[model samples]
Target: MSISFKKLIEPDSDLASVISQWENDPSIIPLTRPNQNQEELDHREEVTVEELMKRMEHHQIYLIYLDDQLVGEMNYMVDPSHLYKKETGTAWIGITIGEPVGRGKGVGYKAIQFLENEIKKQGLNRIELGVFEFNQTAHKLYSKMGYKEIGRIDQFTYWQGKMWTDIRMEKYFGSANNN
Candidate 1:
């Protein structure tokens, strides 16, 4: 099936249901935030939905769908004060696919492709993201997407009764001819 990205502002009932599922899914705890509890999840969901609506105003976040079914979500954050390096700008990214069947089906790579295109359209030179050491799946996917490991924080995250490092990955986007 063809997978595409759609920027979601106010989610419909179907999309809201998918976001709610993602918010409460235990699997996301390790991949997303180490310390997010139920209450925190509720608060985050509200804030995320609101932020996404605002992002739709600026076309910064997108909802992924496969054959019209909600598969995942991605957001690109470009802050000149932080992620921008010289004229080569960069974006901080976040993504999650709540459905199990979506995981190993190449959705991650497709999502990254969509984000990279959008970032390039915005004239950004690079994109970056941080994944917890425990998120091996995402690490592999990011590596597959040509994101190089630039740095790492050893034993920085404490969660799930253990500690894990945070790996910072970057993908440089030069001009079309150079890329």
Candidate 2:
């Protein structure tokens, strides 16, 4: 399954629907955040298409496609308050595979690899991400992709009658590309 990305520009109905579904998907949300019930998720603040467009002005957001079919989305930004203070070209990234068919198919790995190359070309030296402790799948994937655990936030989230930490992982440009 070949993976590719296109910069997210204007929001369309299809994309909006996909985002809404992903936001409300219990299975998907737990992978990124504390496991919350549908009611709580429904009441959370929603990002309108206009808000997303505004965010695009300052971030690199892309739509992930597999064989020309939209499968997910990924985004990154240089954090002004990053520990490296942007001097080392430190950037944080997030990704979501909205389509169930795209999960566990190496689509995310390919997409991240592609985006890493793009970031390298742009002179970024480090890429980082935060994964919930319960997200073992993502932890394994990131480790396989050469990201090392740099830190963690204690009790970052509460869910399922327990507290979960957030694992911070990072990979530097020119490091071993294990994938």
Candidate 3:
């Protein structure tokens, strides 16, 4: 399955649904929401969509669509720290496909493919992502896409009276000479 990249807009029903599903997903919530209230779901969703719109206006976010449907979303941003400011043009990415049928298929891979193309198009040399330790499914996908775990934070989140780690992965775009 091919994935299309688009900008997310406010008042988009599909984006709303995706946000709702993501809120309820155990894997995503553990990382995105640590000690948040249940009532904050709707508010968080609204704010996130709004922020995505603002970032899109700045060329920092990209929404993923599968066959014209809003199945997932991803984005890239410049590395904030000065450590990677020299050689590595780091950009972050996040994705969540609400469709069950879209999970096992090649949709996620296609999204990553589009992400790579989009990052390179924006003149970025590397794409980075932070995945929760328990999100093995996403880890597999990123590994298959040539992403390597460059670092990991231990006990990054203390939520629900439990601790979890976040794995940071990075993928270099294009060959050595190009970057």
For each candidate in the order shown, give its overall lDDT on alpha carbons: 0.72, 0.77, 0.66
Which number leads on TM-score? 2
Query: Estimated TM-score per prediction?
Result: 0.79, 0.85, 0.73
Judge candidate 3 against the unseen true structure and give its global Cα lDDT, from 0 to 1: 0.66
Please identify model 3 stretches exceeding 4 Å from their true place.
9-27, 31-45, 48-50, 57-59, 81-88, 158-161, 175-179
Clashes of each: 0, 0, 0
> Which candidate wins on lDDT?
2
Model 2 earns a TM-score of: 0.85
TM value for model 1: 0.79
Model 2: CA > 4 A from native: 34-45, 80-88, 175-179
TM-score of 3: 0.73
Error of 2 at 70 (Å): 1.3
Of candidate 2, the 10-residue stretch with the lowest lDDT total is: 35-44
Q: Model 2: per-residue lDDT, tens digit, 1-179? A: 67778988798766777776777676777665553444543354455687677778768888998888888888888764644223357778888998988888998898898789878888877888888888899899999988988788777665566678888888887655422
lDDT of 2: 0.77
Better of 2 and 3 by TM-score: 2
Q: Write the per-residue lDDT of candidate 1 for residues 4-100, one digit (tens) a residue.
A: 8887656565566667678667677557754434444334453345544655664476888887887788888775443323234567888888787
